[model samples]
Each structure stands twice: as C-alpha cells, then as structure tokens.
Target: MSETMTIAPEQKAATGNSNKMLFAMVGIGLMCALLIVLTYEGTKPIIAKNKAAALEQAIFKVLPGTMTTAGYYWDGNAFSPLKGTEAEGQRVYAGFSESGTLTGFALPAVGLGYAGEIRVLYGYDPAQEALVGFYVLESKETPGLGDKIEKDPAFLANFEALSVAVGTDGNSLKNEITYAKSGEKQNAWEVDGITGATISSKAVTEALSTSTAEWVPRLYEAKERFKPQTQSHE
Candidate 1:
C-alpha cells in the first residue's frame, strides 16, 4: 500500500500544479483591473475637456463676435431651469450677439433613421421667426441614401424661416410643416424635398416637425417675455 501511496515527488508535483493555477488566476485578475484603471485615468480629462470645448465652439458658431458665457442661460430644454430646479436630459442653448441681443436658438434635435438615431444642432432666428442653419452632430443612417441629409447643401438650405400659421384653437399650428419641390416652395415653412431620396427627405421633415412644432411656440412666448421694453407712458 505504501508503494502505491503518493510519494514526496508526486506530492510536490500536485502542489506545483495547484500553485500554478492560483498564480495564473491572480495574474489575470490583476491585469484586468490594471487595464480598467489605466483606461479610466487616460480618458477622464479628455472627455470633460471635449465637452467644454464643444460648448464653446457651439457658442462661437451660433453667436459670433464675443467669446463669453456670462449672459447665456442654461436653458436646459428650451426653457430656463428656474431658480432651484435640477438640470436634466437635453439642453437648449441660446446665443446672443455682442450687444446682449438675442440672436437665435440652438437646439439639440434627434430623429430615428433607418439604421439608428440622427442628432443635430439647429439654430433658429427669433427675429425672422425661422430656422437659420443646422449642423449634423451624429447619425447612423445609410451611407449613400439617408446620409444625404447631412452632406447635401441643398437639403441643408431647405430650412429657413419657415412660417407656421397658428390655429385659433391653440393646441397645434394650423398648417403643418411641408416639403415641396424646388421653386414650388413659397412660404418660410415650406422645403424642397429631395428627389429620388424620399425616405431621407421625409426623415428630415419629420424631425423638424417633431422638434420645432413644440418648441417654436414656446420660443415665441420667451421672445415676448425677454424682449427689451420700450417706454409706455406717452
């Protein structure tokens, strides 16, 4: 029985196998943890600085002449956060000229494309009561089809001070936003839909409708409130 029992060399081999397994597990775990920590440390500052710079760039693009953030209200969602409210999802950034006059509204807009969500930064001129310009922030649309919304200048130019005839009923506008053929569009609210690219055109039109239909009225209200007062007593 002793002859068949585990000898010193056999016991040593078993211990070596157990030790090797334990060491390998510990080494793998340590490597994973170290990679996580290093990645976080390397990326944290870059992420924050990118966000800040993006805001600065947006402010510059939307409202040129000045580089200050003083008068800008963090209108979290096309409305002021008020005195003591918490900021939440989405932020509507308003820009002003150097003279402290309202220039336009820079809103964050998004829509679902055939592949995924499309994001944009759009500016609306309160004076003209129309869209001034827009830039695509992100999109997962098809490369040659739906992606035209971002690259086509004519498509981009379609948005201007499109007018909305409000109904007396007050729930929604009288006329919904429309896209027509080029030169056929007469109103500030009408756009020239893309030819042979109906889906892309429809996506853009629907996005504008969903975004502006709700916020434009609110902006009208805000414009009235924030309008510089002229003397009344005459």
Candidate 2:
C-alpha cells in the first residue's frame, strides 16, 4: 500500500499552461464580442441617417420635378402618413413639386440579378399610366457587363415614359414588360437590353413587371391619397 500517486513537474506545468491559454482565449473572445457590440451601437444612428438621406435623394431622382417628398404606408383600405416608427404593409414615397402638386410616386422594388439582388426605385405617373423615371438603389451585378444596366444611356432611356397601363380589369398590366436585344426595342413596354448584359437587363424588366403589376393598380386607386395635403416628413 506504499506507492504515492504523483503528477510529474513537467506534466503539472503543461496542464497549468493549457488552462492559462484557455482562459486567455476566452477573455479575448469576450472582449472582441463586446467591442463589436459597442461599435455597432455607436454607428447605428449614423448609418440610419445616411440611409435616409440616400433614399431621399433617390426619391427625387426617380421623380423629376419633385421638390419635396413624403412617405406613406398602405393600410388595407388606404395610405396613411408614415409618422410612427412602426407600420404594416408596403411603404411608398410621393414626390411633390414646388407648387405642392403630386408629381409621381416612387415605388421601391427588388429582384434577383446576375450576381445578386438588385434594389430599385421606379417613378410612376398614374395620369400617363407610364413609368416616368428609374433609379437603381442597390445592385451587385458584374462590373463591366451587368453594371451597364445602371449607366448605359440607351438602357436608361427605356424607363422614360415606358408604358405600364393597367388592363381593362384595372388590376393588371395591359402589357407585361418585355426585354429585347440591344437596338431591337419596337414597343412602348419593351426594355432594351444591354449589348453584353442580357441577364441584368431582363432582371430589371421583370422586376418592373412584377412590381408594377402589384403596385401600379394599388397606387392608381390610392392616387388621391398622395395629394398636396398628405404631409411630408423630414
């Protein structure tokens, strides 16, 4: 009954070192997480402000002659001024001229592109039943090819007065938007494709087709809600 159990000095030292390393790594990880949270909190308001400003600019860009803008959310029945932080259903912006006439509505839409998702704002004139202007809010398309959808003059021209007239039923598009090869646009609703950016061009067309199919009818019905008295916020 005489043998005493003992951990060798080297073993004891190794175990102590391992424990220290484990504790150090855990401390570092916790500190890193705390820093990340702090950073995010510190920048949250700034990020929100920048996003709002960008959206304001985009609204004006998509609706020319818009000297002021206002936001509203569609209730089941009609649009109400977006005042509180919370709301239900899709939100839209109404652009007003200096004289307070409602120029158009900026309808936000999203779609999948060649590289990733594409976000856009399209200006619709209910009076003309046409998309008067277009702006890409966000996109991750290919550099030279797909990005041409944003910059190519010929491609951009497609949205100038592009027709999206509602059908006789008043709830569907008369002619769903179409995409054609470069220089082949022959109809009012056909979007001309970029020479090398077919997918991106089609993506834009499809996005407008789907978004307008749903929104144009609703906006047309709610057109009176966007009159001069809807109230503008910031």
Candidate 3:
C-alpha cells in the first residue's frame, strides 16, 4: 500500500514566509540599482566639466605664455583643427600667445611608476629641440616621496630645456632622456631624480623619453603646418 506525502501546516507557513522574504530582497536590490544609475546620470555632466577645466589649466601651466589654446588632430600626415569626436592616437594641443603666436606644444605622456601609471603634460619647443616645461597630471605614487616629482625644483628644472635633438639618421632622437642619481645630472637630456623617490622620478624620465621619441620627429616634420595666425587679441 502506498501512502501520500503531505507538508505540515507549519512547514507550508514557513515556505510562504521564505518566498515573501526572497521577493522583498529582490525588489530592494532592483531599487538600489536604479538609484545608482540615476545618481551617476545626474553627476556625469558635472564630472566632465570639472575634468575639462582641470585639463585646460594643466595645458596652460605646462606651456608657458599660453594665453589660449587650439585643439589639433594629427592624422599621421598633417595637423588640422580638431573637429567632431577625437580619434584614437590623434591628440595634440597647440598653445597660442595673446598675440596668437604659437607658443609650444603641450603633449600628454604616461608611464609605469613604482605604484602604478603616471601621467604628465609636457611642453615641447620645436625650435629649441627641447622639452621646455612639465606638469604631473596624475600619479599613484607614494605621498611626500614620489609626489616630489611635482614640487622638486631641482628635478623640475630638467624639463626647462631637456634636449631631444634628432639623430644622424634624421628620424630618431639622438639621445633618450634619462634620470640620473640625485645631484648627478650631467647632460641636457638627463633628469635629476628626487632624493627619495628614485622610481617615480625615473618614471617621469622614461615617459618623456618614450613620448618625445615618437612625437618630436613627427612634429618637426609637420612644423610648417602649425604656423601662428598673427591675429592680435584686443
């Protein structure tokens, strides 16, 4: 003889309560997701504006005498005013004086640091074959030590006229920028590392060397395309 299986009243009650709790949890989770999405959407524009402002300030800071800036896109052949969306690997900003004379080129550079990636903006003087200025845009370096790259006067001095002269081949840098031991810089292309932040300092040097090696030749070849407008500002 077979006997039918039946759940007790108490068991059924418990199962119903469990189902209700599950539904409640799922609803709460969906509500939290919706709130997060709404908050992000609301703040996105403000974040973008702040970022743009910061970048503009950094551009001016790195390129001394830059009263205004014009965005340009390098299409591997020539530079033209940037229009519409930015293309990959086509970033270039031209700084102009109050009189609209071309000041310098503020180029973005990045490299791996002791902790993580370091980003910087540097001014390149085509006429001088040198990097004339530098500003650390972002870094995950150790505070008080690695961060000295932004404030160390002696280290910062390196970018004032770091050489990037073309090689005999006429297409590559004659010397790669390198960092020397603190107080050991012996050449225009050598940067003096910070006293206690050797790795971070080296990161800056490597970033500049690698970026300039690729960009200097291209910018030098396209120099004619970046002529000043000659329109004086009132």
RMSD of each: 8.3, 6.0, 7.0
Better of 2 and 3 by lDDT: 2
For residues 62-147, write the lDDT of model 3, one tens digit per residue: 88888877667777677877673775246777777778777888899898998999989999877788888899988989999999
lDDT of 2 by residue, 1-234 (tens): 775588465653345488789999999999999999999999998987787788889988888898888888777677877764743227788888999888989988887999888888899988788999999988999988899988999999999899988888887888988888899989998998888888898899889888888888888877876766544453
Which pairs of residues have clashing backbones in candidate 2?
A: none
In order, candidate lDDTs are 0.63, 0.85, 0.82
Q: Please, what is the TM-score per model? A: 0.67, 0.78, 0.76
What residue runs in model 3 are displaced by over 4 Å at the alpha carbon? 1-49, 83-89, 227-234
TM accuracy, model 1: 0.67
